[model samples]
Target chain A: MPETFDSPPRFDTVLIANRGEIATRIQKACRELGLKTVVVYSEADRQAPYGKTADSALCIGPSSAAKSYLNKDALLLAARLTGAGAIHPGYGFLSENAAFADAVEKAGLAFIGPSASSIEAMGDKISAKRAMIAAGVPCVPGPDTALSDDPAAVERLALEIGYPVIIKAAGGGGGRGMRVVPEAGLLQEAVALTREEARQAFGSPSLYMEKFLQHPRHIEIQVLCDTHGNAVWLGHRDCSMQRRHQKVVEEAPAPGISPDVIRPVGRACVEACRQIGYQGVGTFEFLYEDGAFYFIEMNTRLQVEHPVTEMTSGIDIVQAQIKVAQGDPLELAQADVKCEGHAFECRINAENPDTFLPSAGVITSLALPEGMGIRVDTHIHAGYKVPPYYDSLIAKLIVHAPTRAEAMARMREALAGTRVDGISTNIPFLRALFEDSAFTRGETDIHYLEQWLKQRRAP
Target chain B: MSAIDFSDPATIAFLTEALTAAGASGLEISWPGGRLRIVIATGNEAGVDVSVTPRPAPTAQPLVVVKAPMAGHFYPGSPSRQAATDRLPSVLAADILGFLRVGPLLLPLCAGRAGILTKQLAEPDALVGFGDPLFEIEPQS
Candidate 1:
């Protein structure tokens, strides 16, 4: 199998097939590369700031995401109408969709991500675990195969993996379609419910069982690869500050973890990328528990938390992904890469702070901190209306400093300086979280945030 | 090849199923025998809203205007009806005035009501969105 393409990709204009901050982010990257940008928007996002800033923006469909962003034909037609040479599925939506990538390539347009085959391989959890194990990356204690229909066999496998096993849908991601069984008594019912839920949710009943680490922290290795088989693991991120499996805060260099400990795991991730013939940017998500890394899944797209790694590594990941899409070999080798400083990112969601219900309306007043190592990636401004039809993420607040404690202090200052009015934001919640002694100290597990919230709510 | 009898209820149901399977909003097939326009209003479900625009959203502009029923490339005149463009401002009959070239199929744009096409809002061969204003009509005095 060929790993590299010798010639440059024949494309001048890049179409961003996403909305909000990511779309704005992709446009900035394309502009830096001297490429024209075509942004497609749904009717709800007609007033979105990113659309106006792009070289060309077209309304593809109505307010619904189905009729617009997820509408493959509409997106393709929008690209054709605007004479776009390539499509960048920034994140979510069709970013991890294999068929969309294949269709874009088959339509003679470059898909600014990895190949469809790679996405397919990693999209399925069982196949991804197998690939990771083959590449010497650590995996959880379980078989790297789909569960069979035999109920007795399923129970035996659960017993083998031990109690408190997690049954995950092979096709599920973003923390959906899974159930944790505490003991053998509830195994069958858990499997049946998860199987039915998986079929209804991810359109696949195929599932895999694994030992559910009770207190594992979410660790991700950011990797960038090119068509020439060159790949580099930028650094590690500790996204342990999560609520309901949704990461609310992220930081680079992952607190007290030693380089000697993470270096091999990073290399393993890079090796997995090479084995899969991956191109563009991807994240190898893992669960860190008991001083070991367990491969969970690979996100074949630029992540929302990519900026923290960029700040630490002194690299422009979005631009690098775009250049790789242009058939450009990775300019920086593994040795050339250096991750310094510590960075933290807080997702500013447009939701009620206490209740966390989505609060979408016009931002009548707004204020954000601006200074050294303080960067805010947001599409909303004063008077910008937040739509109810999409993700609640309104902005990403990132800060960097020489040390983890300094970065925490900077984030504290950044959160204090940040303000949004006329609609609710999670700034209050984030401010409270930053003040928490355990999070400030770092190395908190994934379950820490929920526990803290529970403690706070307790009378 | 024999033209498909789209009027058949079984055929419509089958096509509807195919559309659902393909995750398409609707299907419009025109053959020598008949024409079928199936618009599936996927309500409260995970599907696109393929609501067939039977006519344009009438504006206060008392003049009846012609609008696109769906998305396609706008061509001012048809290959068989070249004289249609020349008859601008002419009291056209309830017939084909222009055509929306949707790939190989050219769906006819009907005046639906006899009126004078005062202005062509869209340029020839311009890729237009669904329900986009195509032609403005002025009723006869």
Candidate 2:
């Protein structure tokens, strides 16, 4: 076992346990905070540029994520061997994995994220909704109780919630294990089909029901909390531009919505975190329709689009998360948080822009935009190989400006300046989206991206 | 690069056979960085000869590749600072060499067959996804 860093030991080094852009992003945060970083890589990512810049780098495992990033034992051992005091699971893989967090904490090293229990609770959609309701947070019209096997009770409950309800699995998230019931007659059949699918997909036949909003916009509130019971919401972002539930673009201070409209929701989310003693950075996702926000699932980890909120609020969220993990108090209060500008983030993925198929190969040449209000979070460079084994996301091009229009304009300029060769990317699609009138006016819903893509691809 | 279809049993089986025949003592291939060789062994056990018969690299052309057996972070030394026995300079094949820690317990990260070169892949502690590289070795004459 590695020696524990007790007695108020100052942590000067962090071991990043994931790969790609998030790894580079976390390393930058650590460097800004004057901390050294230790990076690990798989065989497939041997030429990653981020490894070259790290204070120390090592080969952990093979290209498969299961043996590399997901190997909890290996990560702890690295921290033990390198004298690293903390492990930052940037996102995906083991970021929200409760067991990994528990193991890290048991090894006497800080897990730079939420507590294991919080992760467990929020990882399950039903449990999270229950917790949110318990803390007086508004949830969608869904019963807190699990669905019964009785078809009659299921039909009765669906009637009470009204028609056009959605049947969802308790263990489901990311829009899986769900089926929409259009009317009263379809409720029972939907329930049965969803139960079977949920059982097959989530390993649980248990499910819940909710009113399926046809054109709801996706909005989310980012929250930060310390171990000292202090928690605050760090503005909001609109992630309505999605394809099949996966967010394609996100912007902060969701355009056109007044602070009054979102203030109560944000407060409720913060209160929920405090009530549950939640720690680290988290996101409360919601569906906004009919001018009211309906609570959805909570993500108990740093979100991918966190850069947008960071740009708008000018807060180093990753640094704050690390500080919180090190048992530090919240330095800035809710009142101290002053969101100054609008920000937008476009996820640049290596894929077929038309079919959205992943495109993997070595980057022959690359150029990223520089200057004020423009930030590129990525690990790719000229000659860096984009391995086909993992996610297609290659970079996140984010911009901040005094106004939404200015931010949009800056994104246009930044996108034009950026160039990545030897692999197909979504840059062209994003550039075209920026020119769309609906997108410019912020008058689009969750289905807008898919619909736009459909129209563009139609013969 | 072509995507290795891991879902197909044939890929895994072929890889297992190819790895065994590579006779590179041990080889470490990493994503982000590419490949590394750490020759910790001497004689026939220490290397893999790609040009000739699929036999391990002979000492006359000392070159051993230390490939990762699984995916995880790779460590090259022991916890205590006695500075573990060096793998370079081609020690006897029976010599006890460096280690790789998975989490708590230390797993002996061997140089199995021997050689002289000690090239490393992945970093000292970066998160190496599966099949990442660790070391490469070129045997001594």
Candidate 3:
């Protein structure tokens, strides 16, 4: 039965259960939709500028993340106290937590994301891979089952898949609790170690193995789905500039890849979202190698790199996610989706440009670039204290132009003009990176940043 | 013949320095019912004088704070109840000074010590997190 507009659940106020730039971003979206926003914060973020602008701001807990941002009970209590009818988890923290989503729904509030069941299904690597394969989304060659405890069977499976297999925890993501076995001799130890780590970390010892690609680009397809079963892919992003498994920079339309190659992948992502009954915004991460796409996992939340796709597709993804949460059907069909121009997003992190250690202090002075086709999403200003307790990403500097070269040039100009005083930033490193010949050429693999850093460090 | 600890040069020096830093002419601190006074001379070449006396009777105890044990809406009493003034009633250590209403569960706010509830710190029904002060208690004998 289709949900009619009159019968659909509607909410007037949204409690933003996250912090930093995403909180500011969500608040903007809510205000534009004529919905009131309640910004909840930890003690450390009591003075956050967004809090002052929100309809209602409350301190939920102390400075520690576990007691504040990650506290499910505290978040629910805040939502109830503020009279908010819906919650926008933003990203990170409890955004991907299935139990929290279920709790919010049980509390008679809308969780502005996918249903808990979809999150649970995709949270497990084994089940997620099976679902992708069943949906005709390309996946790495491996059995969609946990590795057996029998050492001989594990070795046989590894041998069948060829050497250089990766044993990953079924319950782990974000590049943790995984091990790579370059040869047969190290397979058992790697599995045992990863299994033990997984059990301790994710409370699951179930492990799976897959063929580890040596040189694959990190390309991801962004999709938006509604409760009415409509889904569309909003182009693709190449977040191949990474350091320590974290993306430093991202660009849309993945330079050098023709639309013919990525069109099928995008369609498959949309199909997968529809098959799983997924709703709201999500990303289907893939490893691109040898002109083929292999599904890695699906992030059932708004990604940090979503702005790049938003710039190219000219879509307000956050607002779309909110509308879908309100039981509204997608306003645009697949045929209406058009990705134009080239866009780049540089994650400005508060860290030492050399050592990459977090630098937390007051932003004594600030200057950000402003021009046509440039957007800066940030929750900071002069005198805003960068708290050390949270993620180091202080802002996202995005630029879009008619061509990739122009976008790169604009980014270089933006980086040069950007200045954050009283703390170290990765601005200098980013400036140098934008000038690199290889990066300007595009199509760098996921390991390019680390190798480049190493080359720079060598005497 | 005074019971002052003249044997410990460090104690006398510390007292002398504290008195000089505070810009007080003299200070008399008593222990075991005996008082020792250090007086500073006005001249550039300052001098000190020590004397002893008997101590006086003790005074009243200090005030204590009643804090919220958890985060929730604070209620001074039941919804139907009313108070004549903002002042809170005297409370026992285990008395229910207020309640932290967390989703239909009201956890009692205990004074945790005997005292006169002199002031209500938080507004009634205000959302407060853990450790927020709800009432100020003047400890009684």
Candidate 4:
């Protein structure tokens, strides 16, 4: 077989096959790198600020994501019509899609992320855990093999792994198609229920088992690799401030975890990247509990929380990813990389503050916070419609300072400065959360945010 | 005083019934400087909203529908602009204007009607769907 990482790619244009904040973010990166960008938007995003700013913007389909952002064929067709040399999935829609990545490469276009094989490897939790273990990365204890139909085998494995195990579908992610078993008595029923749910949700019956850890924090290491045999870990992030398993707030250099503790694991992630010949940017998500790291999965695309890492390290991750796709070698070694400051990213979603239900309407007025060390990544403007058909995230308000306390203070000020009118926003909720004593202390875990909300809501 | 949420099934059904009651199989919803014409498909039993307009939002420029000759990736230019202009502006009726490379074969796509090429609607080296626009032409009378 030919060497996968051969010659460098030569391209000056990229098609952004996404909408909202990430689309604008990718376009800015492309422009800074002297690359032209073509933006493909749905009808709902007709008046989006990013579309007008792009070199070329085209309407792909209707507002429904199925016809617009997730329409693989339409996106590819848009790329073809626009003369884009490559396509940037931009974190959502088709970002983690293995088949879409394969199709892009097969159609003689560069996929601005990891190879299809790498994506496929990480797509399945079972295969990903096994790979991570092989690469000497710490993982939650569980049977590595795929689940069998035999009841005896399932029960034996569950007993061996101990109680409170989680039965997860191979194709599951984003807290879907999983069941937690507290005891052996409920094991079979949980497995059977999860299998049916998996078949309906992810179209896959393949299931995997893992030792469920309570109160584990969601930490992730950011890695950037090139076509050449070079990789660098860009430090860690704590996305534990989540509601309903969806991240609402993220911060770089996860609070309280010393560099000495995370460094080795980060190095292991870099080694795994090189071992797999991974290209572009990828994130290794881990569950941190009892001062130990357990690999969960790898996001083979630019993460939404990338800005927090960028703010702390002063590294333009999107630009770096684009450069890697352009066949650039690693400019700096592991030693050259150093995180200087603390950074936080608050996802400003267009949703109800109470129920968290998506609130869609025209943003009649928008007053975005702006100042030194504060960055707002968004595609929304005054009069921009917050469509109900897609993710509720409207913008990412990021702030960086010398210390975590300073960063938090800066975030509070920034949050106060933000004002979105004619539509409900979660700004009020974020403001309260920032003022909370536990959140300010940075001792919260994955379930902390939900629990906090419940406590606040208690009559 | 209120805007309609088109995605709601109730709104869609109401709109369909309203249109049918008005003795119009087709209805055009117009906002300030924008228009959306919904036509009832010929054979669709339930009057499916499949016939949606292909407008690129509201712009000041006069709308000109650019029709694609064949399905392929839209490429605005071949090698260079000089090359594109030389081949495009001087092409006769029978001449091969440009090629749309579908996989391996370079299929020849022609300028069916004589006109001044106002704009190249598609991007260079882009994959185009069947009947998707490639170029905008100002027809010579």
**DockQ for all candidate structures vs. native:** 0.16, 0.21, 0.28, 0.09
Please give, for every candidate in the order listed, the TM-score of chain B alone compared with the true chain B.
Answer: 0.50, 0.43, 0.54, 0.43
Off by over 4 Å in 4: A1-3, B1-141
Better of 1 and 4 by TM-score: 1
B67: Cα error in model 3, Å:
4.7
Cα RMSD for predicted model 3: 8.8
Per-residue accuracy of model 1 over A290-401 as CA lDDT, tens digit each: 8999999999999999999999999999999988988888999999989999999999999998889999899999999999989999898999999999999999999999
Question: Between 2 and 3, whose lDDT is larger?
Answer: 3
lDDT at B123, model 4:
67
- Higher-ranked by TM-score: 3 or 4: 3
What shift in Å separates residue A354 of candidate 3 from its native position after superposition? 1.0
- Candidate 1, position B49, lDDT: 23
Per-residue lDDT of candidate 2, residues B1-141 (tens digit): 435433345644454456557764555433322333333254533332122123354335536656655444556654543333243455445433444445564556666666653666656655443345456665543
Ordered list by TM-score, greatest first: 3, 1, 2, 4
Mark the 10 consecutive residues where model 4 chain A has the least summed lDDT: A1-10
DockQ of predicted candidate 3? 0.28
Candidates ranked by lDDT, best first? 3, 1, 4, 2
Colliding pairs, model 4: A80-B126, A80-B127, A81-B123, A81-B126, A82-B123, A83-B123, A83-B124, B73-B127, B73-B128, B76-B124
> Number of clashing residue pairs in every model?
0, 81, 0, 10
Candidate 3: residue B75 Cα off by (Å): 2.5
Q: Model 2's DockQ? A: 0.21
iRMS of candidate 4, Å: 5.2
lDDT of 4: 0.83
What CA root-mean-square deviation does each model show from the true structure?
11.0, 10.2, 8.8, 8.9
